[model samples]
Each structure stands twice: as C-alpha cells, then as structure tokens.
Target: MLIMNRKRMVEDKLDRLTKGQTAYAESRELIRLVKREIQNRQIPVLMDETDSGCWFIPQKNTTTPSDEQLAQM
Candidate 1:
C-alpha cells in the first residue's frame, strides 16, 4: 500500500541518517527531538492526558475577590 511504502521510505532515510553516529548518542538525540515535536504539535488527547492532574484546579480557588476582603474599596 502507499502508506506502507512511505513509512518504509521514512524509516530508510532515518536509518541512513543515523548510521554514521554512535548508537547511544544518536538514539538519545532522536528520542529528545521526537518528544519535542510531539509536545509542540499539542495534540488534544495527548495534552489532556499529560496535563490531567495539574491543569484541573478548583474553580472557586482560581480567583480571589479583593472587595470581599475589603482590599479593593
């Protein structure tokens, strides 16, 4: 299939690119760049799952009312 061929081509090119570099260094750099790109793309499902814990804070605690505390008046 066309998709399979393209995947093969990309794999080939990546293999060629890393062939000259040391295995450990090349693999570490490749992993870092791939993770950076994935983060930059900001995929919704990935973003939600990655941030599910920290981004969800209680709505009432998000804002403080200075007027209620007699500070704004």
Candidate 2:
C-alpha cells in the first residue's frame, strides 16, 4: 500500500510538471506567431522598458506613398 501511494505521488508530480512545460511551450509559440504576423504586415513597433515591465508602441504611418506612386504600382 505504501509503495502504491508513493507511485501515485510521483505520477501526480510528473503530471503537474508536464502541464507546466506544455503551457510554457504554447505561450512561446503564440508569441512567435504574433511576431511573424507583425513583421509580415510591416508594422513599426517601438519597445520601451520601465520599472514595471516592457511596452509596445505602434508608430504612425508617416511615409505613405503619394497617389501617383500608387497609380504606378
């Protein structure tokens, strides 16, 4: 009975560790996908760090092509 209890405790701990790792991996993948999308859209992002945490600021579009340039494209 004692051996069975020990085995169950070990399995429970392993399960918890596995779940934590899976969550971490999923979050990393999500961040990668978001970064890829931002790059693909050519969005300008400025990062700032403060005492608390980092911040992402989206810059304005100041270099839009003129109508003539668009027409040529």
Candidate 3:
C-alpha cells in the first residue's frame, strides 16, 4: 500500500510537471528527474529511450564491484 502510494505520488508529480512545460523542455526535465529519483531510491531497474518510447528492464543484480573484483580484472 505504501509503495503504491509513493508510486502514484511520483507519477502524479511527473504528470503535472510535464503538463505545465513545453514539449521538448518537459521531456528533458522528466528524464533528469527520473534519473535523480532512480539514484535516490536505488531502484532495481534500468531505463532508456528508444524509437517507440521509454523502456524499463528489471535488473537482476545491481551490486557494485568490490576492490577484489576490480583488482582481478
């Protein structure tokens, strides 16, 4: 329930913001905010823009490489 509420809130804010801005400006701002929100929440998903629209893919693992792993490479 909490997660759904938060998701709805974020979606609502995005909708309201984009609705008030010009098309290209809104697109860029939405992209920037979405990136920031993803980082802030450590969302386990990846997003990208394609010819069709935004593509969201689930991430199996989002772990950062440790020093040992980096050293092995």
TM-score, candidate number 3: 0.38
Candidate of highest TM-score = 3
**Clash pairs for candidate 2:** none
- Across residues 2-73, which tens digit of lDDT does each residue of candidate 3 receive? 333444544654444334421111245455565566567665555656554454444556589999999999
Best by lDDT: 3
lDDT of 2 by residue, 1-73 (tens): 4333433433443343334321111233333443454466555655444444333455555798999999999
Q: Count clashing residue pairs per candidate.
A: 0, 0, 0
RMSD of 3: 11.3
Candidate 2, run of 10 with poorest lDDT? 21-30
- Give candidate 1's error at residue 18 in angstroms: 22
Off by over 4 Å in 1: 1-26, 44-73
Q: Candidate 3: count the clashes.
A: 0
Give residue 55's error in model 3 in angstroms: 2.6
Task: Give the Cα error of residue 67 in candidate 3, in Å.
Answer: 26
In order, the Cα lDDT scores of the candidates are 0.32, 0.44, 0.51
Q: What TM-score against the true fold does each predicted structure earn? A: 0.25, 0.34, 0.38
Candidates 1 and 2 compared: the better one by lDDT is 2
Report model 2's TM-score to 2 decimal places. Answer: 0.34
